[model samples]
Target: MHIKKAIERVPGGLMLIPLLLGACVHTFAPDAGKYFGSFTNGLMTGTVPILAVWFFCMGATINLKATGVVLKKSGTLVLTKILVAWVVAMIATRLLPPGGIQTGLFTGLSVLALVTAMDMTNGGLYAALMQQYGTQEEAGAFVLTSIESGPLVSMLILGATGVAVFEPRLFVGAVLPFLIGFALGNLDAELREFFGRCVHPLIPFFGFALGCSIDLGVIAKSGFTGVFVGLAVIVITGVPLILADKVIGGGNGTAGLAASSTAGAAVANPQIIGNMIPELKPMADSATAITATACLLTAILVPILTAMWARKYEMLRNKEQSAQAAPAQNPSSLAQDGHF
Candidate 1:
């Protein structure tokens, strides 16, 4: 069957499809995990362990030997993405209620949801888009942007902006696995490839585990609000990234637009962060639903926008090249035709 191809056709399918299936199990049979009480239960309730391994394998995939252009492009996008999310979180602290909006068209929306969705660039989506519409270096920029995959960046933004507090040790724990994997991978090329192969295969497993914590009703309640947050993520992160890409990274804005997405892995962050800070626990489920919606929305939109922008940029570039060559090819004809 073409089941794998079918899923690949959906935005964020490997992650989202499994996530929805897990959500179904949670919604319909909340006791299934305990009832099974074995490896099945472990798969049902293994978000943290699965994620830890995923992070480690993800780290192994980064070679640290990327060319200067790739690093510069990625660095610009990553920093810009985080900075924009931080700024939004800071502003949101004052504008939105601490617990989030309690009523109205924006019901169930929270600062945690906004920041989580905004902070992480969907590296898989961006890499795929860039592969089609950008330079090879731009496609490779996902190597660095992958750093935004876990909850660490969200924790940093929330902590720095006073939206939440986290102990110093929590910060260390968050990145230790990834850092160790990175060191080992750099030390031995074979180990890097071995661990790297595990990265994609692990997505659905963790996605399912993460979804087991969510209720579909929450997703239904927050559907519209989630779509809004997804749009905000793209616009809020997209503009600065584009400017930074052009001015500093020496490229058109396509890469920046491509990077303005919510990572499918980001769907787990609010839940993870909420567990770290008990005060934030109440909103985690709703935040996950909202962030999941945002992940799907941006995965679809960013590519279309990036492709349009790339084609336009290419056409203009070609037109300019033709214009520049006109004088060299036929100056006499131009003068005779009253063009000079």
Candidate 2:
């Protein structure tokens, strides 16, 4: 049936497909998850355990021996993304109330949602876009971008912005599995490959479990606002990323534009963070739905935007090169015509 290929056809399908299925099960047969008792119910409801393992596997896939070029390319994008989110969050804290701004179209645009949407770039989408419109190093940059996949970065941004407070131990606990996996993987080559191979298959399992926590009704309420947040993410993060790519990464802005999308895993962050900080519990559901919508919207748009920008840059470069070569091509003719 070519199910994997078919899923690949959809934007962010690897995670999104399972998420939608879980949402359906949650919405239609809410009790089904509990009917099969411990195994089925536990697997369906136990998002934290599944995600913990996925994070471990994800960390194992990272190669610390990445070349300087890959590190620089990735480092610039990662730093710029996190910095932009931090700045936006700080601004929101100053301007908005503690609970967040509530307008008719968008009820709650809090630091939590903003940072959640802004902090992480979708590594898969960025790699795909860069492979088509950017340099090889840009695609390889996903190695570091994947490090931003979990709740750690969002928690950091929130804490830095004074939006939420987290304990030191909670921070350690959040990233402990990843750290362990990274250590073991780097220590043993065979362990790295074995665990790395397990990463992709675990994505759907955790994705579905994450989805079980979301309600489609909540998604409907936040859908339009989520679209707004998606566009805002691209522009808010895209501009600085473009400049950073040019200045620090020494490449065109395609890589920057490519890094502006929200990661699919980010849909789970609001809930995870909310559980940690009881104050954020009230906004978690809305934030998750909005973040999921934003992820989908950006996943569809970032690639198209990067391709268009690349084509424009290529055309301008070609025109300049042609202008430079014109004088060399017909120097004798230019002298005769006196145009040069």
On TM-score, the candidate that comes out on top is 1
The best candidate in terms of lDDT: 1
What TM-score number comes out for model 1? 0.96
Question: In candidate 2, what are the lDDT values of residues 45-144, reduced to their tens digit?
Answer: 9889988988998888788999999999999999999999999998888987787656678866677888899999999889888888888888899999
**TM-score, every prediction:** 0.96, 0.94
Q: Per-residue CA lDDT of candidate 1, range 156-261, in tens?
A: 9999988899999999999999999999999999999999999999999999998888889989989999999999998989999999999998889999999999
Error of 2 at 76 (Å): 0.6
lDDT of 2: 0.88
* Model 1: residues with Cα > 4 Å off, grouped in runs: 327-340
What lDDT would each prediction earn against the true structure?
0.92, 0.88
- Worst ten in a row by lDDT for model 1: 325-334
